[model samples]
Target chain A: MSPPVAPLGWSRWLVPPAALSVHLSIGQAYAWSVFKPSLESALDLSGTQSALPFQLGIVMLGLSAAFGGTLVERNGPRWAMTVALICFSSGFLLSALGAATEQYWLIVFGYGFVGGIGLGIGYISPVSTLIKWFPDRPGMATGIAIMGFGGGALIASPWSAQMLESFGSDNTGIAQAFLVHGLTYAVFMSLGVLLVRVPRPAKTAADGGPAPLEGVQVSANSAIRTPQFWCLWVVLCMNVTAGIGILEKAAPMITDFFADTSTPVSASAAAGFVALLSAANMLGRIGWSSTSDLIGRKNIYRVYLGVGALMYALIAWVGDSSKPLFICCALVILSFYGGGFATIPAYLKDLFGTYQVGAIHGRLLTAWSTAGVLGPLIVNWIADRQEEAGKSGESLYGLSLIIMIGLLVIGFVANELVRPVHARHHIPAQKEAVDVHERQQPA
Target chain B: MSTSDSSPPDSSPSGRRGLITFAWLWVGAPLAYGLYELVRKATQLFTG
Candidate 1:
């Protein structure tokens, strides 16, 4: 189960594809919404009941990443990828059986519980490896891996829709669809398992091979104890929450904002709007995070949070006055959201060094899980209350926008508060050597 | 960021270069297809 090590003069470029295979496959999580309507109609389920699988899947994503991060580091990417393939693919297979048997609980347990573990593990598997491979461009390397996650849905959304169209959206068809998905993804993700390689330790500590970085070699356990880690936690949570605000209700929000306008948006255009946001989300992961390599992580996050708050304000103050203006602002905000996710592993690499970055990154994902729930709850609950009070059009969303702005502002402050880790957190060189050796051997 | 271990230098052999090309194409082809489909869908915003 040990990871494959790169031979002398291995091309670092190969690493991103390995990482992308896993990321893109797990990214199918985002496309789950595409299946929601079909499931509801077929099973006579409520909207909320149909939503159970996706919500549980996200919750599991965070928990598994947090708990399994250290295990991933110890076992290496090969072992991690193999595990992800089994759990994730089996999740679909289980759902196939559930759909065939008409047992919704089985679908939830399979796709949400088992599949989500794959999402978490696959998400972080390539992060530290990419950081190690491209130490000089850590942000860009990690960006390439994470961008696949954002783009995964773009591929899956249409592909799944087409499959449902062909196979029929009824129980038997749904079973066939799930079966195909499981087999296809398992085959696709295998390339990553075959190709992943860890770098050979550098001849010198400065060369950034499995060595202590910037003289700060904090373990993941010690990292969680640092003020720096908590600050990033708040920062990531706030950023994700803010981005998810628009993302969660994008179609509805856009529709409501323009419902009373001279030119209200149609349903088709709203779907297009969602697709546009996905494009922006995927592009931002690569574009802005790569820019972080040039401009620095701190400065780029300042843009994500500080400028992000301003974008919310723009949307609020302008109301539904101009469609183009609203879209541009939302697009920028969503881009910042993607940039935040892509840049964080590099930020962890910066603050704690690479010794336990993947593990630390795993722990930090608890913030994403939190934001995933919090962002939608705050937006939806407030919108529901406003609607009850006879609010309509842009008025229903005004308060939600204000709350989003506040969250971004808090994130901005958290990003600013981040500083270098204290010396006490740095592992001594001898102990660091021993820990690295332990990491290399199979557990 | 202060770091080391660069990914690809200008110097490379043909065999390794071909493999790199293959690896990137393997991922890039799907990503590009997805992007094209997304862009096609997003065009509805203006067209509709």
Candidate 2:
């Protein structure tokens, strides 16, 4: 006989811990910059060269999540969480080994290739589960899970910095830090795996009535065929690219922008700026996205794409003339960046229905992978070339900011393209009616 | 379509009572903490 399923009660509550376990562990990705100074000093690498691991890790995160989405749906959350635990923890172990041996390629392979897979899988594991549990509040449910992803960095940034400080900030220290990360995360993530339980179908139906379906229904297979899917893909790609351009180089970019101005960014102040941006990114995931439920999905994207472009323009034009302006524009831009991630699930729910939104969401993450590479490359590459041409400080990043503006404009157009799917694609009403009528009027 | 015409009433709430308890222990606290953290983080951003 098959094992007894736990009748669904409050499995919804379990979703957050599962989300935090994955997000907090993967959030270590953001803390990589703390180790950059040590790596450069010990390995004698250039800035761009040192950034390779982080860039590759992000690239892999998008790819693995996109490709593994369908498999996750079929095998269930337990399997996905297990794979994430193994890959993410092992990535850290391998990075520790690489650091100890002074092997850069190993670091790339372990942290970027292996760990990135963990990041992607872990990121999506709780999202669909949370949505299923809280059908009454899809946006709020998703926001709760995604908010962990944003805050993961807040906890990790300070913790990693403290570890590096204690461990000597040298190659040896870095390796030891990596070992601690591997061991501790393995323990932390295991709690989530143990606690996670899939809610039974009967229980899910009991928790909420048919009201969960709202006004639309679209199967996962049909969802991919619609123009709405492609429009959302464009929207996500543009939003991520705009935000990550600044995030990938938060420290250097801020310092560069203010170097020639009257108020030079001190080392501590630069670190504070990164912390502040991270805080904004985390907050926006919950705040702006929760607000989207009240304000409608389309209206919210208008703010993200429309206001986002204006923020970029202000930064590019004004330079560093006003510190308050610079901070305000960056905060708003980061908020939109974060809102893009938090809101996309609801956007999927809006257009495709919740049938297999997890799988559809998995497929959509390819846009994130594409933007992950494009955003950083456009900004860093342009800035590098400009620096070589004798540009310095704020002037170094001006061209990259212009490119971000162009991308946001395209995203705005894509958001405008979104509309409800045609009724022809919905599940056949006659078939649904027959199923219900058969149960109502006995054989 | 009448209010009294839906599916039969649940007879297994007792069987799943343990699970309801488990859900609170496992899921509720962590989910609540995560939200609290988000609010705390946001306040830091706006205020700082």
Candidate 3:
């Protein structure tokens, strides 16, 4: 079915809110840590057991997005959003029921399997719509919407904690919290469904009108075949892996680094560091990605990967001695991490075209999944080995930091290799594809 | 592909502004609340 174009008098500006509504709600995935302690205690589970839901949720998010991408493209944003709302909210409700009954398995099935699908679908749902609405500034448009996902945890962490506190951290209380989350998100996401509008299709080039793509347009299928896609894939994976080294260990690493200092870092201060990182992540999504509109996407990645490697090296060299320097490095790195995510859609649009950018983006998210695993494993495992070897303080992270620098350098190289999709890979300019394209452009 | 739709309805400048405002407030209110919560949590580092 043709996507729902904005009605007459509908301002294209309104579309971002619709995208944000869904994004902000699904971004709650990042806050699952808030419920971990409660689940472990109430369900009498081990740390690893309690973590199953969150880990599986992430795995499913990648899997579902990779698979559901084309289905989303075929059906349009409305259908995608509705599916996301149902699965995501229902995942919460089911988990609520599971919590009430103390069935850990049920909670896993509900949250990990069902809720994860919601996360994936909701994540990609707005991308194409936002790109269409802001064709002039695709990076800034997707940045605004994806930034919500970065900030989702900032909203959800405290909200979930307060709910657990007020309702009692027991089983029923957890259930109540889940219920509230499900219901509230359902209502909130409905607004996006109601408010979002696709652009009216453009007139054909034959009619002396602008085409949707200003340059070479590659279909998702053809785009995937090009070496350019794989190069970008490596670029994204390496960048995320390097950044996750710091993010996954922000609290513990900070405390460990400053333990021998005259003024030791406290637990509360470490928490603040995490909060600051979130702020950096959110701001970078909007700020750096918007900057990419001027600087060019390829140049922005150079900053993220190249300068980011330099920042990691600095952290390794002077991190423990200067708290201010450490904080600055971490914030800049996190911002680059967020910027990396926000810019990729526009990058894909540049290389692949808007026609299947969402689907292509979905496939690309698998790189994120890989980096998610690679980053944490490298950082945490090395840190663990260091601790076993009787290392302490800043020494604990020294090697891991070095490794991150190397990974970032690799990412920088991969980025430098990216070139425009070759003519051989461009989708043949069929009349139907052009028709679909014209229908999507704004008047 | 063919262009089949009629001309778009003309929107007054004020109407466009009002709609943009509506969209902003709709998304902005929640984001502002989120930021408020973050600031409150962040204060713990200094206070604690």
Candidate 4:
């Protein structure tokens, strides 16, 4: 149960790569959409049936992260990363077996359940550590690592698509792809397990060394009891709901919108659209979060939620009449979405301090899980109902777009309501003083 | 808690530079590959 350490004389900068290894590997969760069509056709499954594994995986990701936050905090990043590696890779291995045997439930249980645990644990493993390492730039440091999660899908989408193409797209091909993904990611994530290290205990500030407690510290247990936490919870959930609503249906929505135009979007063009969104997502994670370090977390989220709502309104108003406008709106909304994710850890740190920021972050991700369900359900259900009523093109999505705009407005209000945690929520100075005294007592 | 607590300095200058270089390569390689794929996809949008 000792904290992790780098080899003799290693620099703190090396830690980000360790975080990236785990995030890039588990971030494959974002690319699950790439497998949906292949799995549906191969297994004789309906769209809903095919979506089960992905939907459930997101649910498990939030749930596990919420519950496992403490264990990760207790155990250190090496243990958390190792556990993530085993579960995530094994989830893929089990999914391969499921695909080979044609048991769809196995895929759901394996990828959705086991693999998702890996996602949750792997995600939070780096946050508290990164904040501690770059106390000077918590936003930027976490941004660098979390941006990998956004980029993960960018790598996996084309890679998985190519793998399916070469391997033949049959049951066996899917299994082979799954197996390769599992093995490769396992090896890749191992670098994180090997390299990540917690800083050695801080020396006194008088010695010109790292000192703990740079700001007011709120323990994780106390953070949840405050109104600020729940307000942020709403803000995150609504922002994600708005962005994911579009993301889950990006390709089809574009085609449906532009189909009647002279320049109808081809399927390949639609895929390129998805990649463009990923690029924006990745770039915004780093770009906006770093900007938050300067502008402050609260001000940046005003842009994410408030301006994001405006983008949605513009899309709804302009409809599909201008393709460039449509794409531009979508890209900006998605950048805010990614920015929202990247910035929240620092937001929590700003309010709660680095003491249990990781655990607080884990609790906050329940918002993502909730949004994962709500976002797609709102978009797809409305679109499906609209289509049954004979609506086509932009009409199919217009209402859904409006609904998303409303959600973003609600998120904007929540963000506006967020205030600093009250003094009652902060850890009593006496308790902290006693702990420091006890630690310094000769062991 | 007050605002004056400073982050620990890196153990050494060369070691810090080496670690930064190592980190860039390790994380940067995969990211660059993803960017390449996205570029390829983007080109298809116009090329077609």
Candidate 1 deviant stretches above 4 angstroms: A204-214, A441-443, B1-12
**A1-443, model 2: which lDDT tens digit per residue?**
11112243434555556666666667778668777888888777889878888878888888777778766755666677888899999998999999999998888899889998998888877676666556566677687678777766666666777788899878899999999988988887876676665544331233332223335767667778989999999999999999999988887987888899887776656666766777678778888888888888899999999999999999988998987798889989998899899889988887876556777898898888888878989999999999999999999998999899999999999999999999977876444333323322213
lDDT score, residue A413, model 2?
Answer: 97
TM-score of each: 0.95, 0.80, 0.94, 0.91
What C-alpha lDDT do the candidate models reach, one value each? 0.89, 0.76, 0.86, 0.85
Docking class of 3: acceptable
Model 4 residue A106 lDDT?
A: 96
Superposed model 3: Cα runs more than 4 Å off: A205-213, A432-443, B1-13, B16-19, B46-48
Model-by-model DockQ, in order: 0.40, 0.12, 0.40, 0.42
RMSD of 3: 2.8
What lDDT tens digits, residue by residue, belong to model 3 across residues A1-443? Answer: 55677766667677788888899988999899899999989999999999898888899999988889888887788878889999999999999999999999989999999999999999999998888677778999999999989877777888889999999899999999999999999998887887777766655647645434446777777778888899889989998898788899999999999999997789998888888888888999999989999999999999999999999999988868898899899999999999999999999998888878898999999999999999999999998999999999999999999999998898889899998888887765564356566545444
Candidate 4 Cα outliers beyond 4 Å, as residue runs: A6-9, A37-43, A205-212, A430-443, B1-7, B10-12, B15-19
Q: What is the TM-score of chain A alone in each candidate?
A: 0.97, 0.85, 0.96, 0.92
Total clashes in model 4, counting residue pairs 3 or more apart in sequence or in different chains:
0
- In what order do the candidates fall by DockQ, top score first? 4, 1, 3, 2
Winner on TM-score between 1 and 2 is 1
What local lDDT score does residue A214 receive in model 2, on the 0 to 100 scale?
A: 37
Model 4 interface CAPRI class: acceptable
